[model samples]
Target: METRYNLKSPAVKRLMKEAAELKDPTDHYHAQPLEDNLFEWHFTVRGPPDSDFDGGVYHGRIVLPPEYPMKPPSIILLTANGRFEVGKKICLSISGHHPETWQPSWSIRTALLAIIGFMPTKGEGAIGSLDYTPEERRALAKKSQDFYCEGCGSLMKEALLPVTSGSASSQADKEAKELARQISFKAEVNSSRKSVAEPADLSGFNHLPSSPEHQQESTTLAFQDTTPNEVSENQTNSASSSQEQHNQPASNNTSMSPRQRRAQQRRVPTSTNFNQVQQPRVNTNHMGSNALILLLVLALAALIFRRIYLANEYIFEL
Candidate 1:
């Protein structure tokens, strides 16, 4: 059994570099690759302050492919955020479900920003997306801080510190620009090598050029005040409710009323499956045309036979 993947590969190295450089510029979100696997990462996202997700810290998992930066990752929320289904792959233009839309230059930072912003918007009939009410989202958001993943070995709030002092986008924007610059440089190098028909040796290619000062800043986030006591107390009951709702299979919905079931079904987008519609139309047309031709042939044969019989009878009488 082969258990090793090329962790030293160009794609893997780039991801590792990005992971090290992942600083919470906005302090609203914190993410890092797992200790055991560089391809697997977990992140905590802070809800927008004015939206229903305000004051909420949501936890989720990101599974990057071995060919990452080219292929998008699969993202699943572990926390029971009302906007998305727990432990399910979210359907977003940036997620693995839509690789065609994924740009090789896009990093984890861009995806995180998209997720935070998309949380409060309509579900758009995407998988793992939901249209819960604002009040429901607020309730879930309040409880999200308490939810923990054993894999990360830390509570959502304990691991990621909230930004209390500085401006939100200052640090984040700087990190993003630096990442984009690195990506562009790498792309240019790859294109140049390809044009000359040279075998590219990217083992020594360290585009971002890791800095000691940048490494120190990763651990410098300040913690904000915790959620209210009331929010924590209600979490005990809401925890079970959220878990039950999250774990419950979609197929076991006999308990749901007709209206409720229809509502749930409607959340799933109808596929543009041409086979379901076009096959039936073609079959009906083909059958109708064939039957009409057969009927016409039979009628013509009968008329000819009747005329021949009448002519024979008249000849016999003469």
Candidate 2:
């Protein structure tokens, strides 16, 4: 193992340390790197108590990546416990399938504990998951003890040490259970939000009115808004026209009969009334005629006086 993997490398060093720490199996779990490969490990985990998988001893494989703690490992169940398919890599938040949720602080022990905590949960149709009934699961739990792996041998029945109360593994189990619960809760919340938001988006499109109906309503509102202004404008125009007619002189009333028209002409000023108003012009013409007659009389008097003077001169000469 030393020659195959560089001991100086962090991944190799970390795995070696974990191997040393877990050399003695706990009552609930046991894991160790294979002699041929430091990156591949074989583990055995006892099922959680008070569940269908209780009393089951299951074996599995853990294949670590070159990145080690920076990346997560892939888990494959070798024993059939009815919750996951045998020999298939199972998806878990602590597994390689969900590296985004894995933390460098988590170790192989944590992964095993998480698996135990998750066994009682519904599979929810995930890859490598199963939804066997309680009766089936309980039957399979009893059968898991005899399951064997070529690499790990027939140690599945006695893979773990006898349970000791108040051991450190019990505390680690509690922490693993809490971590699993948190991961499951977050996944449920995300799914619920997506389910709600999808319908809201679709309903937004479903409730929209058609274009023709929207346009007709807009047109009706536009007419209603302008009606008062149009009516006020028409009233103002009519008032102004009536005021103009009241200020100016009246024209001929075609609606009146001939007698009514004559009566109106007499009552109000007309063209014949304008002739009566020209009486001063006639007086002015009369004054001019009187001045002409005075000039003609003066000329006749001068002519008679000149003829009498001529007659006296002739008598004197005779």
Q: Model 2: runs farther than 4 Å from truth?
A: 1-3, 164-173, 186-318
lDDT of 1 by residue, 1-318 (tens): 434557779787878778877844336677888877778898887776568887788888999987888899999999887888999999876789877567887888777766776776678688999888889999998898888789987586675666564665455534444543443465456556655642222222233227775334322211113355654655554575565467458638588655555455444323212222334333557778787667656666765685576567657756
| Model 1 ranges off by over 4 Å | 1-8, 23-26, 169-318
- Evaluate residue 298 in candidate 2 and report its C-alpha lDDT on the 0 to 100 scale: 60
User: What is candidate 2's CA lDDT for residue 136?
Assistant: 95
Query: What would the C-alpha RMSD of candidate 1 be, to one decimal place?
Result: 26.5
The true-versus-predicted C-alpha distance at residue 189 of model 1, in Å, is: 30
TM-score of 2: 0.57
TM-score of 1: 0.52
Q: Give the distance in Å from residue 164's predicted Cα in candidate 1 to where it truly belongs.
A: 2.9
